[model samples]
Target: MNHQTTTIDLIRHGEPEGGPKFRGSQDDPLSVLGWQQMRSAIQDEDQWDVIVTSPLLRCIEFATEVAKQRNVPLHVEDRLREVNFGAWEGKTTAEVIAAEGNKLSRFWEDPVANTPPGGETIIDFNQRVVEGWQHWRDQLAGQRALVVCHGGVIRMILADVMGIPLQKSFGAVSVPFACRSRIRVDQSDFGTLTSLHSHG
Candidate 1:
């Protein structure tokens, strides 16, 4: 088979209206700054064949706007949503430490072995995100695509593409709000991650 290349732009959704907290599974919409951030991040990109986004409001809202403005097809993927933080949802780190203590710390340090109470396990979350990545990678082969997703999801995808171990994936790279990453998918279905950019 001839080699085909697919270019995918992974964009983390802008800041949510809610202040810093475990936003996993939280449906907060984008704040004013969030809208500005997404708008700015995409300003440089001229076009895309398709736009995909997490089902969460934080990602989908801006993705919908972009899809409409750019006249691109939009797809909502639940697997791309942020890992559900369970009881930690909407709680700050201090509060979580006061509540779960070592378990939360363990989760922070070694996500694969440690899991937050009532939250999705890192292994499961990685599998889910991988499925989404594979689906899109195959579908968008030989085309340029954009995905609006969460920081965790973006990190997971990047780790998979770069062969980074799951334990080191969480902080291996920083995926700031409205950050954009580029990935190239070759004909063999392997992904190579390149470029880290943020909106001004």
Candidate 2:
């Protein structure tokens, strides 16, 4: 069997209209600056064969614009959406910390073990993101693809590619707004993290 190399560029959505909150599953649109930030992040690149994005507004809006501009196919993938934060969905970190105290700290320390009150568990989130990633990898083999998604989604994908334990992945990866990460997978299905760039 001939294996082909696949290149995937993952980018976190820019700032949403809602400023600095948990934001998971909130469906907030991007702010004006968020639009500018995303535009600048891809201004120099136009080599994608396809664009895949989370269904959330923050990711899809920009993905739609870019796909139309470049004439590439765009796919809105629900599996790539940010992990549902449940009770913490719209609350700030400070708010969560104040309300949950040590619980928040424990969660940060070991998310796989300490899930948020109503949030998706780290294991489940990783599984879904990886499933989506594998589906694209197989479907778009040998092509360069762009994925516009959330910080959490990017982190989980990176962790999977790098063999980082899920328990350590949450804090181990820092995906700032408009951050771009590239992964190249060889015919053997081995993935390499080629580069990471952050607009901020």
Candidate 3:
């Protein structure tokens, strides 16, 4: 179906406590507030045609509950998973900072050629997620959708959609646990996007 318009509710999963050093790939459950955050977003909304979730349990914990309420089919997509931090998964942010120092900060500040040590590059990540989203956009056509995913992925989507440069995309946007960002995906000859924000 040619989807002329699609509403894609992009949501970031709940937060977690400081676990020594946190990095990508390590698994952690959402905090209590995280559940509360998800509750606020899902309970307030009554209808959703489909609910897609990240493969990680962090997002699944709250997403499962949302699906149960709306009786929406839950599909797990791996592409939405956070960037793989490889060996740095369990280390605390401080630990990684201390070990990598300026380089780590530089990666956060400017991930152009810099990348997480033993982790996926930002360019590859952007392409992976955008391609994944495009595939789904084609499938959804004229429909509303809800997807639960990670923070980094959400920022990447917003950055790409809003034309925000990835190097400076790590700004600490205060997103409450399980908070929802409702965006309408407009389809046109230019492709799917929101005119309100273009990728910077």
Candidate 4:
């Protein structure tokens, strides 16, 4: 059996405009520095068959431009959005601490069991992202593509690709703003990491 290889680059969106906060599902544009970081990470010679990105402004804003410039197809993937923080949207850790007290800490320590009120559970989020990844892997088989998405979404996908336990998925990988992780998918639908946790 001949195994086909497909390369996918997962890029975390640049810093958001709003100051530090849970910003999940809280659509915000990228900061000026965010744009610069993205531009710096990619180059004109970079080749991609398609550009897949989250619908959020931070991810789409730059993705739109890149796709246009490269004349490649751009796909807005909803599942690529960040983990929904529910009621905690747009609230800083300090603020959440002041109001919810230790709940915030508990969530951080064990997010799978301690999901935020009305927020997405780690299991649900992981399932959704994994489905999305598998769908794309099949659709873009043997093609090189760029996936621009959120920190949480990227981490979840990385965990899925790396076979990390769902319970320890979050924070298992630290994806800084504009960071890039490369994944190679084989004929068996398994992914191998070529490069990871790079701030490019």
Highest TM-score: which candidate?
A: 2
lDDT computed for candidate 4: 0.84
lDDT of 2: 0.86
lDDT of 4 by residue, 23-140 (tens): 8899999999999989988876778999999999999999999999989999998988899999899998898999899998787667898899899898888888888987897789
1 against 2, candidate with superior TM-score: 2
Task: Give one digit per residue, the lDDT tens place, for model 2 in 1-200.
Answer: 55577788899999999788998888899999999989999865559999999999999999999999999999989999998888888898999989888987787678899988888999999999999988997788889999999998988888877788888888888888998888887774454333333322
lDDT of each: 0.84, 0.86, 0.71, 0.84
lDDT by residue (tens digit), candidate 3, 1-200: 45487777878777665522444666687777666666766656456788888878778777787788778788888888888866567777777777877776776677657777788888888888777776776677677778788767877777766788877766634344565676677777777666422111
lDDT agreement of model 3 with the native: 0.71
**TM-score of decoy 3:** 0.83
Candidate structures ordered by lDDT, highest first: 2, 1, 4, 3
Clash count list over all predictions:
0, 0, 13, 0
Q: Mind giving the per-residue lDDT tens digits that candidate 1 earns over 72-117?
A: 8999998898999899999988899998868776776688887777
Query: Residue 118 in model 3: shift from native, Å?
Result: 0.7
Error of 2 at 119 (Å): 1.2
Residue 69 CA error for candidate 1 (Å)? 0.5
Top-lDDT structure, candidate number: 2
